[model samples]
Structure formats: C-alpha cells, structure tokens
Target: MDHKQIPTEIDREVRIPFQGFYNTAHDNVFDMALEQINTDDSNDTVEVISMDNVEWTAVRLGYAQKYLAEIDKTLALNARFSRIIGQKDYAIGNDILLARVDCSKLVELHDAINADPARKAAWAYYVKEALTERPGFIPYFSAEVEDWGAFGTWDDAQIDCMLAFRGIELEIDETEIAMELMEYVDEKIWSSVIDPDQVPGHVNNKTETQLST
Candidate 1:
C-alpha cells in the first residue's frame, strides 16, 4: 500500500482484462517493475528487478502451506461428497461434486506427470527454450535456476536457462506493481500511516497510559 516505496523507473503500464469471454472487458491499468538497462545516460543505468504477481502468489501459497492439514481434510470431505452424489447419479448438488472430482483429478495428473521421467525432461526442455528465446530477463533466471533444478534431474544447462526466464518474468511482474504505485505517489495520495506531528504525542500517551495502569 506504500506507493512511494515502489520503484517505478523500470515499471511499465499494462492493460489487464477484467473478465473472461468478453469482447470489451474492464481495463485495469497497472505498472510492473522489470529490469532494464539504459545506455542513453552518460553512465550505464541498470535497474534492480522485482515481480508483484509472483510475490503475491508466493505469499498466498505460503499461507496455504501453513494450514495444509486443514486444507487436506476439507478436500477429502469434498471428494467424499462428490463420490456419494455421483454414485447415486444425482444432479441436484453436482457443482461441489464436480469441483471435487476436478481437483482430485488434477492432483493425480500432477503427481503422474512429475513421476514420469519423459514428461519431466520435456517440461525442462520447454523451460530452457523459453529462456534462450528471451534474453532480456537473463539475470533473474540465473538466480533461480538452482532452485528449479533441485526439483528434478533436469539438465543443469537447461535448468539454468529456465531460471533465467523465470527471473525475466519476475522483473516483469515487479515492474507492473511498481508503476501502479508510482502513479498513486504522483497524485500525492501516498503517505506514511503515522505523521511526524503525531510522534511526540503518541510517545507521551504511551508513557502516561503505562504509568496509569
């Protein structure tokens, strides 16, 4: 929410579609922070990259991981309910049932794909290709390649390439968030929660309240 803190130089504006299957969807203009090098400056200017979407997703998944056991139990119950209704050929409450089926199937498919050596190799190759084709985001992927390689027996070179690609993607996402924040800052709407004028009063009140208690 602190817009001023967001670095805006490398961040660029993008148009996001609001809904699916709409010829004219609401346009959400946001900024993404990405790595860029400017040679036009008297000295070379290299900006640090960031990604808001990946950061947000990581935070959300981290929360989900914290409550994984609870999530597993809920998923289990949903799957059971789905099975029961499907066995009875009932359509009255099919939505949840269908959802459960889809979720379970997706999990099974993921596991199967992961376990397949051929599929894993294929995926790694695809990632490598993506990285090689996109050179702008090389530095970021270089940082992440080791982590990606640790997941499987993907070729070191291929994993490195993928990591390069991931870094670029991260930069793109960061630039977007940064740009959006910069706009708000430009409007003078961004400010610290505690104003300087309130600091002395806040400290005095805290001391007085502690003494009274």
Candidate 2:
C-alpha cells in the first residue's frame, strides 16, 4: 500500500474522502479495522452501508474549529504524542494526541531563528538541506499544507490504538491523520458483544475480525 502520499493527494481546495488518506504500512489490517469500528457505531439500517467517518469527521471538525487553526505543525518529523494518560487501562482518552505547535506560532519561531544569518544557515540546513531520504522513511519536502483539522474530537487513546493494535510505534498527532487511521483496532481483539459490566472487555476481546460471509 502506498504511504508516501495519498491517491487524491492533499489539496487546499479539494476535500479528501476517508479513503483518500494514505496507507503506508498495514494494508491488511485496514479493512478489518473499518469493519470493526463501523459495527461499533451500530448503523443497523440495511439502507445504510457503513459508518461514514468521512462525513462524521467533516461535521465534527467543523464544530471543533474554534479550537483549531488554519494550520498546525508538530516540530518533530515523526508523529507527536502528548497528554499522557496515567491509568491502568491506558486506552481511554488517548484521542487527545495532537500536541502540535500552531503554524503561525511556528512561523514566528522560525523567523526568530532566521533573524541571525549564521543561525539561519544552520537552521535552514537542519530543516531543509541536511535532511536525507531513506527507504520506508523517504523524506519529502512540501511548501503545501498537508491537512487542516477540525481538531479536538477523538481522545489520544482512540487515536493511538491503530499503532497499538498493529505494533506501529509512530504517535499520530494530526487530527486528520488519526481520523484516517480509524482501522487501528483489530476486530478479533475488540468485542462485538457489549457487556454493561465491561466496555473495555468489549474493546479487547478475541472476536471475529469481520462478520461471517
């Protein structure tokens, strides 16, 4: 599965559907994840095909804009994770993983560093020139804004589960990126049978990854 970029690519003018999100690593797990999460949503109507996360996110993100920015950035090249949850379960509230620096603020910081010509050259090299590309982690430069978030919907627990279930270690902090990774939870691991006594049990039980065909 292609991961370096999406099929539609990120467009400032065009809205990308849920399927357009890039899938670099776990292609097999994605379908299973989508099925599992859809079941969790309980859209039992036969007329309705599945949980519409694209629509869901669009609405949610729109409502969440007061807290969002025109652009947000994580200083690290890798996905950033923050707002740690210190609990025995450790799965709840994980959706609040987006600990990014607002790009406006980031720009100020960048400009501040660039004020010193010597520092600017060093910083430019560090940010732009010196960085090299490698396999599975090919580096790409972009002047384009990759994604805009209707941020602050899912908790970090929900956001991190994709990596957690697949043993993928990158912490996904972008709201849009995490939204695209809705399939992180393995269906066999998360239960379809809901017990009022244990929601966590439902989330982690060994169950079928897909409905019987």
Candidate 3:
C-alpha cells in the first residue's frame, strides 16, 4: 500500500486583527504591562480595575487634535471587537480598555500659561500662521474646536492658555514656537507596534525583484 501526503498552500491574503492605540507610546507600554499585571492578580472575579495617577505631560494642541481625529477615524473605519465603554470615563477591564484625557486638566494648564501677557501674543501669532499658511492644519484645529465646544470657543484665551503651559513667552517668533509645539505633539501622537525580527514573505519577493532589476 502506497500512502501519498497531501500538498498544502497557505493563503497569505488573510490579515490578522491589529490592536492598540496610535497616539502615545505609553499607551502600548501600558497595555503590555497590564497583561502582566492581570496575570499576577490573585482575584479572578474582579470585574473592574482602575490604573490612575499616570503622569502625562502637555503635548502640542495641534498634535493632540490630529491624534484624536486619527483615532476617531480609525475606530469608525475598522470593524473591531473592542468596545468604547464610556464616552468620557476612563477604565480598563479584562476584555475592554477605555482611554480618556482630562480636558479640564489641560484647560487648567492652559489658563496658568495664558496669565502671562507676552506668551498670549506669541500664541496668537502662531495660531494665525497655522490658520493661514498650513491648509492641512485647519481640519485638526477645527475638530479640536468642535470637541471643546462644551468648554467654550477655541479663541485667543484658549490659545494663550495652551502656549503659556508650554512655558512659551512672547519674545519667541511664531514660526519657531509652532515648530517646537508641533514636535512635542508629534511625539505624543505617534506610536507603533513592530516585530523587528518578523518579515513578511511578500517583502522577500520584492527584494528579489529589486535584485533582478
């Protein structure tokens, strides 16, 4: 009796569900850390857990606005299993992770900074440049304004508050100040999950093509 092994070909078209947040590196780190923490927890029946007092620094307003927009878009586009537990509450459970930022805290920080007159002027200049010169910048700013509608308008007072918190003074040029602020925001809003050792088979095929060409 002869036995023949069946040939099999794995379909590479199937994509695995990717999880985690886009903004803030700490978010991913916290996710990994939480897994470890939950495994170590003695109580099995605990339904809710609060991880508070995670110190966060103020990022640039533009960056935060962009990051939030990206997150909202991603959530809307992707059909994922994750649930948004609360509209304004922050909580993380076994099957769910709720992330939220304290707008009031940010507002307070902004208020303290805007108390300085010189900083307020510098912030105004920066905002003007952002509005007129950078077309791409407007959407994110508009979204932020809409989000913060409940807290009043995104006027000079609000802009001054944000600038003041960054310890920015009126002596600095608007362009330079905007650049600095954007850099801070970029850091806060950029995050990724990369498996350095893993390379897709399609990548190898592309490299082979390049070599032949």
Candidate 2 deviation (Cα RMSD): 17.2
lDDT of 3 at 89: 25
The TM-score measured for candidate 3 stands at: 0.24
Q: For candidate 3, write residues 1-213 as lDDT tens digits.
A: 111211122111111111223333424444434344334357453312223311122222223334334443422222222222211223332112222323343444445535667755565565555444354343345422223343333443444334332423323233332333444333332211122123221111111011000
Best by lDDT: 3
Ten contiguous residues with the weakest lDDT in model 1: 204-213
Give each model a TM-score.
0.20, 0.24, 0.24
CA lDDT, every prediction? Answer: 0.28, 0.30, 0.32
lDDT of 2 by residue, 154-176 (tens): 22332222123212122333454
Error of 2 at 1 (Å): 48
RMSD of each: 22.7, 17.2, 23.9
* Of 1 and 3, the candidate ranking higher by TM-score: 3
For model 3, where is the 10-residue window of minimal lDDT? 204-213
